[model samples]
Target: MIGLLATVPALIAGIRALRDRVLEVAASGATVVAGVGLLAVVLLVIVPSFEILPKSARDAERYEQQQRLDELDDIDAGFGPGSAEEAGQEMQEYVDDALQLLEVAPRTMRTTTWSKSGTTAAGNTCRAFHERIRLGDQVDRSSSAERLRTAWKAESDHTSFFERNGVLELSVHPAAATISWIRADNQLIVESDCIPYAAP
Candidate 1:
């Protein structure tokens, strides 16, 4: 009977060890399953809902919209009624006033022909006059050139005589309340072209 009691205790110890090992295995399996589930949540649900998703496509659409708006603004800026014609009329008046000065250039400084061309914008005008002064029944070139210079001095507020590359240059700017010019052999005068005509 003593031997029987000893065997019964060993059998109880073996059953308890087997039960502890089964419990440990079950806990480890549960931990692994929990970790895998958490990883799945992060990858499949959380990542797809992130705000940064689709950011590139949104930025591209915004860029395209801005480009379209800029093009429309450019097209609308040039569209208007009579804007072109009004500019033309104002420019012509400015040109006509400037031409009057050429008509009145010293009567002795002969001009073979007048070729005037110019453009006006923003209430300003630019003119280019091509003039030719030919000797008129005068044998002495110096005396003839001097006579013309004297006449201009009498009528102008500024007079200057100089030579460049052995070519004589006499420039005069008469006191015109409207336009101003520098004249010599040929002339390039720059001043406001739209000012009201004032007799020099």
Candidate 2:
């Protein structure tokens, strides 16, 4: 009877150990599954955010904004004329004079592409090239000479005055000092230098 009792207890202990092993395996499996689920959730949330699609979208938006800014700058720089007839007249007058102030007018005009721009000066709204100047039919030579002198001043005063007076708006700088103009036809133009045209 005692041996029988001992055998019963040994059998119970064996069964209990088997049950605990199964429970431990189930717990380890649950832990692994939970960890995998969390990893999947993190990947789903984070991977798309770093993907190329969103980054490219942001880059495209930035490029569009930059283009809009350039267009606005062009508008502000005075590249358009209010009236075609007036633009033509301005171009024609410039052709006749050939910018005597800057002998480079013809050559520079030939070398560089001309484009229309707009600017305001002396409270008058006039359409002209930002980097070029074309005198009105009544433009005084002394006045033009004075303009040249002011531009060639040893100090940077000429550049400041040019902006303040609206003599020439330099949108595009050149290798050498340059003058720009337009003809009555509203054609854009440039001159390398106009100091030679100034009166001695």
Candidate 3:
């Protein structure tokens, strides 16, 4: 989506040049071919950059998850296993910081102030949510973590996280302006309306 949006100006320029007949037919054809090729290359380059964005999100999520794991380890180290109270306390702390760790709403998030619809929805609320995970760890269906894990796994066109039973449910499209359920929360929380584009 970002790739396509970024390419709009170049696409427009190419079209304008062709319309103006700035070059002979043969030259224009070559330019068209080159433009198409450049588009392909740009898409390829942009695809990898998208990976960087999500991977960074994943990394932060992992780190936060690990921090919780470490806290659990420390609690268990002192109190032995089955320390639900301490674990829950640690989990609460984990929940508090999970969203930040995921960096779901990075300070650099791009927002379009101009409304395409010419009117913005009133009383809209947006917030970012994240669920944490460890490296090589597949989502465990039995745990609440599955809520976010499944969403991330099922990422595709028109999918977004909605909340149900204090957990996130992935669906074709979510109503909220922006919704992100990272592995840390395992629940749906409102995300930034500032995001006009589709989720990564």
Candidate 4:
């Protein structure tokens, strides 16, 4: 009977050990199953969903708002920390460009491209080419040198002109130097052709 009692305690210890071993095996299998489930969700669901889901512009709207700021460089042509005096250069270059736009260079003058010499030469050639413009069917050659001097300043000052139409048209500014003109039926002729006609 004492031997039987000792055997019972040993049997109880073995049964407890077996129970612990079974529980450990079950926990390990469950961990593997959960790991597989998580991996399958990532590969099948999460990865495939990338194609269906819409993405962001990464705050592109915010970037566009920043672009409109005055601190940003060259927001547009009107962007300014500019001075009123700089507009004089703008006005100057405007007429220079007009020469090309109107196809009127006749020849670059004895001086710079848009200098007094160039404008005077341009005025002379324009007068020679279109001097036949009729005022009451009367030819007006009031004086040659006076017309030349007047034409010279007209190009600079933006004043009354008829025979100097092409060069004058080019000189007249849209805003700062606006001048009214009486457009003739035949004027604004291309000055390239006028070069040969201009006096030597």
- Measured by lDDT, the strongest candidate is 3
| Model 4 alpha-carbon drift over 4 Å, by segment | 1-58, 70-200
For model 1, where is the 10-residue window of minimal lDDT? Answer: 190-199
Cα distance off (Å), candidate 2, residue 59: 7.6
Better of 2 and 4 by lDDT: 2
Query: What lDDT tens digits, residue by residue, belong to model 2 across residues 1-200?
Result: 34334444544554555567856555555545555555565566546657877889999888866665554454455544333233443344333444564443443343333434333321222233223343444545445555455544433432321333334332222212333332232222443221111012
- Indicate which candidate wins on TM-score: 3
- lDDT value, residue 43 of candidate 3: 70
Worst 10 residues of 2 by lDDT: 191-200
Better of 1 and 3 by lDDT: 3
The residue pairs in collision within model 3 are: 126-191, 127-190, 127-191, 130-182, 131-182, 131-183, 131-184, 132-183, 132-184
- TM-scores of the candidates are 0.25, 0.27, 0.29, 0.20
- The TM-score-based order of candidates, best leading, equals 3, 2, 1, 4
Better by lDDT, candidate 2 or 1: 2
User: Please, what are the lDDT tens digits per residue for candidate 1 over residues 135-158?
Assistant: 233224454334444443454345
Estimate the TM-score for candidate 2.
0.27
Which residue runs of candidate 1 sit more than 4 Å off their true CA positions?
A: 1-111, 120-125, 136-138, 142-157, 175-200
Residues 85-172 of candidate 4: C-alpha lDDT, one tens digit per residue: 2323444444344333333444532222111112222233211111111122122233322433354354654433334532233233
lDDT string, candidate 3, 61-148, tens digits? 8886665555445434553213223222333333334334343343433222222211112212212222233212233324535435
What ranking emerges by lDDT with the best candidate at the front? 3, 2, 1, 4
Each prediction's whole-model lDDT (CA): 0.39, 0.41, 0.43, 0.35
